[model samples]
Every structure is written in structure tokens, then in C-alpha cells.
Target: MSINYPKSIENLIKQFSSLPSVGRKTAERYVFHLLKQKPEQIKLFAKYLHDLPNNFKTCSKCLSLSEENPCSICSDKNRNDKIICIISNFQDLLAIESTKKYNGKYFILGGLINPIENIGPDKLNIKLLVKEINSKLKTLPEIEIILALSPTMEGETTSLYLQKILKNPKIKLSKLAQGLSTGMSLEYVDENTLANALKFRGIIK
Candidate 1:
């Protein structure tokens, strides 16, 4: 589709269109909306976009993006270190936290196992996760892992792979119960449903 706007507006629209779920029409609307804003407002928006990458660092333990190295959750002394909730990404971690039903540490897997996309265990943070867990075992007497992944096919595959590799008599593994519907993403689920799922998590055999 050809844009009638001049080069500057067209370039801005193109950049906006490059974002996820944003088409040319949507990008045009976004650009027009910004055009109506005051110069200071637009500058503030540009500043945020420019500083986003430098504002946050990945937590060494959970791999969550934060301003600090360990992140507030991983460094929290009040949290239950014996329980670790494994999630697919930072969004899932935030979803679970919104429920306020869990007080455990977390490990972000980075991504799920999807053969079609050529993403596998090697592409994810599984190795770091395993190493982190085993290393923590020295301090914590026993550990319980809560697999809080989505109920999608890729999520299931990743969970199974984790179950196999993390198999240990000392470590107990469990997954969120059917409180969450199949094929649903945790980030979009309501707090009540997520809370129920965490409350009724089942052991994975």
C-alpha cells in the first residue's frame, strides 16, 4: 500500500508498522495521534522509546528484565526460595505476580519448544535454569517446581522436556491445574483463574 504522506511521516509510520500486530492503517492512526500531541509530549514518547533498552537489565537468576541484576523478586528475602515457579517469559511472570497468590521465586525459560519455528531447548534458558536449581539445592533443603506455563501444545512440550531433565527424587515437580483453559495464555487470563490454577496445581509424574 502506498502512503500519500511525505517522507518524514511515511518513515514514522513505517517504524510504527514494524511493531507487533500493527498494520499500515494502525500505524498511520498512531502517527496521526502523535501528530496531534504537543511537541513536549512527542519528545517524552521518543525519550521513552530511546531509553527502553538501557532502562532494564536481565535478572541473573530469573532472567526477568529489571533495572537491577537479580531483580526485586529474586533478591527478596521474604519470598519462599524453596519454591520456584517456572514461566515462559517476563509477561507470564508479571501475570502470576498480579494474582498475589504465590510468594515463591521464579525462573523464566525465555521461550517454549516449537519445532516449526526452529526454537528448541538449546534456544531457551533451560540449561541455566537447571544449573540454577541444582546450585540453589545446596542452600534450600528441598525444592518444589511449579510449571506455570501456558496450556498450549508448545507449552506442554516444554513442560515435558523440563520434567525429563529435571527428574530427581529430591525435587518435586507440579503444573498449574485445569483452572486455566487449554490454549489460553497466562498473561491474558484473569487474576481469579490464575489464582485458582496456582492453588490447585497438580504433581507431574
Candidate 2:
């Protein structure tokens, strides 16, 4: 049975509940935790959330959200411009970056193709990726494109779709190696596993 929370508490609970993996009980706990915080703490939290829209800009080249247009990674000259690791989101990109093993460029696809969610190739950043690769090939003779997406069904579907669309003599496509647990998202994988996967990425046909 649901307790009759006050209107303000109920509204906050609903907002928290809408977040991924947050159920009603989890949301309720979150709200109560916030309520226990000092007023200044709550105000700081609200300020951060409110200022999020003004805080960052999406990198034009990779679509990663950062304080600058072309994120620090994209701006770094030391990174391998001939290689691009394609990921579903910023979280996964950070996961890969944390490994410190990869020295290549990155492209955030925004989302994977989940037919159940009505997401398809068109909904992702495929067009931009193709355009970027085509443009990069002009300056560079060859480019390596790594499909570093999650291991879930949607991830596989998106990878397969990408395999078909990103065809070019100069583009060599690869993906995370077989050791990753099936259906595991990259964000949750340990740094060692992620680093190994990048080190042993497999060629895609």
C-alpha cells in the first residue's frame, strides 16, 4: 500500500521514479534522503540540475558533452585521428577513456538501435558517423572504426546495422573482443576488462 505522501514529496518522488532503474520505493528513499540534507545542500543540488542546460556544449565531431564544442579528446593532437571508437553514450565513452589504454578518437552514437523502443539507425548518429569517416579518409589514407557498444541485443543489432552502412575501402571495422559478458553494458564493466577488450578488439566482417 502506498503511503499518502505530502504533495511536494509526492511530486519529487515521481520525478526520481522516472529515472532509469529507479522504482517507486527507490524514488521514495531518494526523496527522503534529500529531505534529510541541510537546506543549503538541497539548494546546491537544485542549482546544479537547473544549470545543466547552460553548463555544457556537445562536441561537433564526437557528440560528447563538454564545456567546449570539440571536446578535449577531439582537440588533443596526440590522439590517433585514424581510429574512431563508436559508443552509444557519454557514460560508455568515459568508461573506455578510464582504461588509459586507447589513444584513438571517439564518437558517441547517442543511442543503440532498440526496435522495442522504436529506435533504429536513423535515430542514432549513423549519418554523422558516415560523414565524419568519409571526410577523415580524405586527409588520412585509412581509418579504423571500432564498434565499442554494449553486448546486449540492441547493441548487436545496432552494430550489425552499422556494419552494413559504414562500408568503405578505407574504413576497417572492429568490435570489442569475445571475453565480455553477453548483455553487459560497457559502463559497468571493470577497467581491466574494458582495457583488455580494447586491446584485443576483433575484426568485423
Candidate 3:
């Protein structure tokens, strides 16, 4: 199981393999592909890697990965500030946005509650969500927060906790409709199904 490549190539392969779902063989292939690229192209690729963390920062407003602090969606005047869709992560937020059925703001919880995995409420951005909502309410008359979570047990647990913490007559809470079915991840759901779920979301009352 000896790797005969140069130290530089070996290090690059190891780094690539560290990425999610990438095996050592695939990482080697990627490194070889980069070797075939023009010198300028390789420099450009390296520059992009160097700049990724500097440019793509976690949005302060919605906790999403974006170039801007508030992110384009959070700062967009056309987006409805009165409605905020709380999703498990940035991918789920993208999935919902792809449907074009929702034009509301979003709050990206870093993850859902899963006690078995040691991921609790404190691990996610729940407190920041409450603070953001209260701050927004200062300007807006009222706001509706939708729990756009997955149908898994963890998602349910997170949604219930959000409901409990956000319980109030002035603030409204809701969840995606039954059409989403049970045990489906929002990130992998089809556009039509997700769109319908948003269209017919149910109030938490």
C-alpha cells in the first residue's frame, strides 16, 4: 500500500481525499487532472482555494455561507421580512429557494437536534434566530416563522424545540404540509413536492 508519487502530489491527494465522500483513488485522479492543466490554470485554481475562506463567510444574519455579512437574500428589499423559513442548513435553504414558491427570508440553523450524535439545541444557531426575530419585530408589525425542516426524528425534535421557545401570541409559527411525507430530507426533495409543501404549510396551533 505504498504511494510512489512525489511528496507534493501525495500531500495534494491527501488533502483532496479529506473532502466529503472523496476516496484516495478519486483524490489521485483529481490531482493528476490538475497536473495536466496549464500552469496559469493551476495558479488560478490555487488562488481560488486561497480566497475561498476569505470571500465566503458565514452570514451574520441567517447563518448561511455567503460573500456578504447579511447575504443577498437577507438584505434584499423584495424578500418578505415578515416571513422567515427556518431550515436545518444552507443546502435546505437552497432547495426551498429553487422551488420559486417562497420569497421569504431564511434562518439557517447549523444543524438539527440529535442527542445520539451529541448535537443539541446549544450546538445549533437557535439563540441567534430568536435574537434576529426580536430585532426584526422592532420594525415589522408581525412575523411568521416556518419550520422548513426534514421529516426525520431529529428534524421533528428541532422543530418542536423551536416551537416551544418561540411560543407567543404575537409571533406565529408553522410547519411544512403533510404532502412532504415522513422520513424525507428537504435537501433531496423534488421541486414540485417542496413547492407544494411551502404552498400549504400548516400553522403550529
| Per-model TM values vs. the true structure | 0.93, 0.95, 0.86
On a 0 to 100 scale, what is the lDDT of residue 203 in model 2? 88
lDDT of 2 by residue, 106-158 (tens): 99999999989898788888889888888898899989999998999999998
lDDT by residue (tens digit), candidate 3, 20-51: 89999999999999999999999999999999
Candidate 2, after superposition: displacement of residue 40 in Å?
A: 0.8
Cα lDDT of candidate 3 equals 0.92
The count of backbone overlaps in candidate 2 is 0
Mind sharing the TM-score for model 2?
A: 0.95
- Write out the backbone clash pairs for model 1: none
RMSD in Å for model 2: 1.7
Off by over 4 Å in 2: 1-4
Stretch of 10 with least lDDT, candidate 1: 178-187
**What's the CA RMSD for each of the models?**
1.8, 1.7, 2.3
Q: Rate the local accuracy (lDDT) of all candidates.
A: 0.93, 0.93, 0.92
Please state the error at residue 122 of candidate 1 in Å. Answer: 1.4
Q: What's the distance in Å from true for residue 90, model 2?
A: 0.7
Model 1 quality (TM-score):
0.93
Q: By TM-score, who's the top model here?
A: 2
